[model samples]
Target chain A: MYGDQGFTIFDLQLWAEGLGITFGVFLSSSILGLIFGSIIGLIRYYNIIGIGRVLMLGSEFLKNSPVLVQLFLVYFGIPALFTIDLSPVEAAIITLSGNTAAFIAVIVISSIDAIDKKQLEAARSFALSEWQILRLIIYPQSLAFAMPMFVSLAINQLQVTSLVSVIGVVDLTRVGDIINQRTFEPFIVWPIIGVTYFVLAKLVERIGARLEQRFSVHQASSEI
Target chain B: MLDPAVMMEYMPAFWDGFIVTAEVSILSIIGSFIIGLLIALLRISENKVCRFAALFYVDIFRNIPFLVLIFFAYYGLPEVGIYIDAFWTGCFTLSIAVAAYVAETIRAGIQNIDKGIIEAAKSFGFKRVQIYTKIILPIAITSSIRPLGSVFINLILTTSILSAITLGELTSASKIIASTTFRPFEVYMFLVIFYGVLTFALSAVIAGWHKYLNRYNEA
Candidate 1:
């Protein structure tokens, strides 16, 4: 029972565009999160003045709360309070990046803790500088330890990207919502959207596994 | 500017919303725990098909976003003549969705049981069901309180997503007050702190419970 305004080639174009936006938002937020999360982790690691405690407290709030509320706070709340312009896409990126950074900061600290304390002591006795110890002793091992957690986090965050649609970003979920409203085909439309996300998550898992293996190999060879 | 007076005026509505959130979270916690326990059993069963089916359920639910799953339940169910309302829809989807996570946690707990204990139970003439209920599940469940607590805390946060379906939960209520008060900043900022404190207090209680349950192991 194909209606006159049923699925068309242009829907395909819209689908592709939605996929691109989803990937764009996910990738940009993830990279920014990783960078900022690392900085937060390092500050805590160094116990740099009062800033570390304040940053950690902020991160705890970020980690504990729902990302949806965070998105609304940034999108609707901040702009209204400041009387400034902030688009939905910008708000989505800002909120997701902060949320991702909260989780990543925890992962970084835990992974670094996973490394043996004696390794740091050995490096210190060998007259290694702080930078040298971090570079040569701590970094690689922690990366290996953190890889699995990172992969799982990536998968979780990819699924989280779906929430951006609530704030009016035309991501994959929003595309499904639009088509479903028009076609009245929830069964057909939502499944396609769900499968797209499923496939994307699987891809992330596959690449993460590969990266995990590579890091483990590097750790082993470098150990010798 | 933050306005305490504006927030005070909306306290009644926010309190009502918080009650709904608490109700849904409690119901879903019980629901997911039961479903997850069953799945964990099926996952570790001797039957190959049971294990495979359990694995498939976990994979599908875990990979798909909760919002997609909620939309499917909300919209698709009505079309199929199921006719469940939004509250039940949120609870149903959440129970099943969070069960995937609960199942994984319980399964991990189950697998870590010592093989000798199972054999000991068997040698003492315990039935398979008896062995599972009395020996395996007790140990696994007691040891997993901490992890299961985190899962439940996460489930509480996820109830906010139910707002999208017009369920009038805490976030939804906050949205209404924000628009009415024209103080989105103060409203959402308070909401954030509210949720953060809620989770922090929960995890603290859970940590105490976990420690109490596993106190024997510490010695």
Candidate 2:
């Protein structure tokens, strides 16, 4: 029925706008997730008082549960409970960031653990403060180790951004839904949206591979 | 604001929703595994067309959001006059989506198998089908039990998304409870914890099973 309506130029603008929103949300939340997750990881690594345990428990819940539920809780539930207004985009950002943080924290913790204890001890003996050791020793190595996992997590979180459409945020998926409803062309509409995501994921994989190659060059040369 | 007391009365409805979620999750898990196994085989097939087809399926399904897939199936199936209920639609979409991940994991497991074992099987005069069924599959499944378990756990978490299409699963059930009781916070808090505990328990079982399966190989 909608196929007869003919594709309008307006649909192109809507798709572009949707792509912008989706990428905007993904980039912002990813940055927030990295920062928040690293802090949580550091706290757990240092075994900071009772707060470490609390953060770990909270992160566990965040990681284990569905992001859709988390979105609903933050978007619909929280405002009702606290009597504060939260726009759909704001709620999506908060939930996605928290969800991404949980996964990122796990990656951070494991990557730090990959470092040799003896190396840390050696650094300490060299008069390196805890902060200095973390900055000069732990950060670089852990980042190299965490790069692949972080890349994969970023891709997954990008897909998770589609769920924001369910709560009325007009992201890429929502834009597809709008066009599909009006045009009633599931065959054409969905494939275009799916291809866009596929291309974006491929781009992420390409960038990640380049970074991985660059980081491993030192080890590659040393071995030879 | 609705009274908290009124919401307490809908516990039965919420429980019913929980039951539906559990049922759909269980059914879909089994369906995905069976389908995943076949797709996994196709992915590793000697025939180039089979391999390419499987790769295409996995790539497209994996890259696309599950919500879009579900919507397509939910809407598209009816347009073609193939009517099915919400539960089946949810299960079908989940199986298709999850099979992509399962195929990837299984392909990895199959690739990791030692060449020596296959040679030995050939030397024993085992037919190609027999070798796959009797040896390759068993080895691949055992080695991949842990990864497969996580994939299934993720599938369970994904079942919550089915609520969007009116499946009345856990999240949808809680949505109704939240609205009716005007206790969105309490309802959703309970749901988050419920899903967390469910997934945690599933992962623990998986970890236990992985340990058991690899007991002889332990360091």
Candidate 3:
């Protein structure tokens, strides 16, 4: 085996590119998951036809299984089963989004439940439509209640994004592995990589705190 | 193109892998629990240094991903002249990594104790040790059992990453089976379901235990 290759400026470029991919995948998957999960949560809340139970069961499996296993299933297993060409990034996004959605569903259901039934009943007395009640009452309160949890979950999901590297996605963790293999400097390489993630998470936490403060204003109900 | 019958031949091998996973999980659960308790105690200590150190430990561990930590322990330790095998490395890393979460959960439990209860304990002339051991800890831990159980369940899931370090755990064994059988899809899918069912059962038991312990506090 060749001794560890010395570090180069090119390696820094690779690191930046890898960071981009990691954040790109994390952002897209999170937004998509939130959309799908809110829909699932709303369906459950409204008790839609025959499918809510099935959806919940699906989310449970998604929630409970290890992300690495889910990644493998999507990247390797699905291609072998269906004879379809799948890029590592595509598989990573699909799997991570599904996983994120599962958690979002749980949060959505609980946050909605946190709102008062009396609020809905009161809205009904005012000749308000269901949609109007949802938009005017349930949305603001549930979002306020859900803010802290959403922030924590976002931070956790950023860490979870590292697992995508296992499926051959050239994310930050994979970049670290490549550099560590070449440089033979585990101590230097990994701490840098880990610190990158930590800082990103801290950034998310700060923004979330700001959002939480803004939402806390809505937490106080009007006397009208 | 799915065939379930192929798995029948690999059942014994899978069983062996399951045993390893179970062994490692049990050991780490115990290891982390002890560490978690100490750290949680440190977090609430009267001494400022102890509290700061404990918080720093928890912060670093919680922020970094488990895979990164596993790689660090598995590879970085060798450089520092500690030559443990993959199995021990996996166990040690999992314990230390998970202890962050366990400490936080336990700290929350401890903090959730009603200030009034501790004041009453002080009025009873129970000293600090008695207040902690006899009065506060039991109520805190029992009340927080459900959250603590989730931490354990997460610890079990984290064990699957040990396979990445080539520790012949359930995932690694299944990897071999999948390659040999030419059915990667079925093998991994089965593994997903198996882990899902395992965690679901563990959570159910934890819920039951929480209910039983909190029977007196139920509204």
Candidate 4:
């Protein structure tokens, strides 16, 4: 059993599949989180009645709690209580995306606040409507300010995706666990898994830096 | 639909787990604070090698997930003939992993120090050590109290990961209660709120402390 299991090409296929799942969950959840979180942030910015404060309270707990516990709640707790079928992958996506939204919401609010109010007033004086002012004046500057935080958040969330494995999502970490169990070589298996994540993080950082530079350029050119 | 009565029965076991979590958290906070402070200092040191080493330490730990690092320590240590229980391994891992965060915050704090103040201390005939102990570190550390508080709050939350190694921390203990009581939803939901409230209360206090420390400043 062990001889056939030792470093097979099939194992490499498994690793690739697991890495794909990890990246897939990460990218889709991040996109969803950004859209939902921005809406929440916009609600808060506009001071939407009752809804804003309730959303804020919910996100506060979401942000403060451990992601592992949150995963268990979504994966195990939700199905049992709600009597709904939630596969591991679905649960991972739901939980990670919601978690990401909570964080991105905070970043959105703060970055919007970081925009100078006089800029908003100046746009208003130029007879711009509220929606036009948001699109033309507010969006670009706040996005530039939020880029660095967004980058860090992306890197952190990528690592947080590892927890999905505990819920049985067969991510890279779970694949490592499977191979380690079969071969009983923790020393080799774990380092390989660790380096894979490290490289992914570095890649995210490089991409983020490029995005930041581009946004800053946009801000600079607009100011001129 | 959570029965508070059912949850209450597990309080004794949960309390024991809370004690373990508290011990690991306190030890790690102390450990990370010292290690982070040294690295923060090293990052600002004159020698290029020291600076590079510090940067390497922060980069590796900060990017790698704590779960991975913990798995590495928990599984890899005994393979090399270094046997230790999950408790110590957890404490050690948390300290090293969290120190990266603490060091970054402290580094930012140290860099924020006014150059004129350091120059003023030097001109006042204070030795280099005195300048650091008296003028530099105090201002840097004080200014960074809020950020460090958040870091420590995060460290407390990270303690939950120790459960994966079967260390019987809060998460592990609750896992038992959940299974035995057949109430995974209720048990974990309660645990989530427990941690959320704990961190929320902590950050509030840290904010007040930060404000108090900066009260004398005109800035």
Residue A70, candidate 3: alpha-carbon lDDT: 89
Error of 1 at B131 (Å): 0.4
Model 4 chain B, poorest ten-residue lDDT window? B1-10
Q: Candidate 1 residues A80-151, lDDT tens each?
A: 889999999999999999999988998999988888788788889999999998897788889988999999
Better of 2 and 4 by DockQ: 4
Q: List the residue pairs that clash in candidate 1.
A: none
lDDT of 3 by residue, A69-134 (tens): 888888889999999999999999999899999999989999999887888888999999999988
Per-residue lDDT tens digits of candidate 4, residues B154-193? 9999898888889999999998998898788989989999
Model 1 segments more than 4 A misplaced: A1-4, A218-224
TM-score for each candidate, following the candidate numbering? 0.97, 0.95, 0.96, 0.96
List the pairs of residues colliding in candidate 4.
none
Q: Whose lDDT is greatest here?
A: 1
Q: lDDT (0-100) at residue A117 of candidate 2?
A: 84
CAPRI class of candidate 3: high
Could you give the C-alpha RMSD of every candidate to the true structure, in order shown? Answer: 1.8, 2.3, 1.6, 1.8
Task: Give each prediction's DockQ, rounded to 2 decimals.
Answer: 0.86, 0.65, 0.81, 0.76
Task: Find the 10 residues in a row with the least total lDDT in model 2 chain A.
Answer: A215-224
In candidate 3, clashing pairs total 0
- Whichever of 1 and 4 has more TM-score, that candidate is 1
The whole-model lDDT of each prediction reads 0.93, 0.88, 0.90, 0.91
